[model samples]
Target: MDNNGPAYHEMMELHEILNFKTLCLVKSKMMSGLVFDQDLKALMEKDVKQTTAAIQDLQSVYKPNGGIVH
Candidate 1:
């Protein structure tokens, strides 16, 4: 309430989003390796990169102990 950061509830919501993005990132990275089609692998790699950036942005906004979650 005093740190000018998001409210506790808002932080929790962001945490959920961060977790989901992280999962997507992980899955895409794994799937990209398993994909046989070059085009599909490229697409999954792109998704992994985008998800990594999204998670970084969310971490900047949702830091709880002045550290990135996970």
Candidate 2:
């Protein structure tokens, strides 16, 4: 049995969440093209923005002193 990696368990979890957020953003953008209603399209765009901010927050967990990841 071997359990060794660069990131800690909690950090790995955050990384995974960040990946999910990114995927969701991409999927939302992709599906936006199929959204016929103007309201729904706007909602999806808002979600994309929120998801982007969420990813940034999640990445900050890995940064020192809550700084930006990049």
Q: Tell me the lDDT of candidate 1.
A: 0.80
lDDT of 1 by residue, 13-45 (tens): 887888999988888988788899998988898
lDDT of 2 by residue, 1-70 (tens): 3434334556666667777888999999999999999999999999989998887777665653333344
For all candidates, the clash counts are 0, 0
Model 1 residue 23 lDDT? 88
The candidate maximizing lDDT is 1
CA lDDT of every candidate: 0.80, 0.76
Q: Give the CA lDDT, 0 to 100, for residue 17 in model 1.
A: 89
Candidate 2 yields a Cα-based lDDT of 0.76
| Model 2 regions more than 4 Å off | 1-7, 63-70
The best candidate by TM-score is: 1
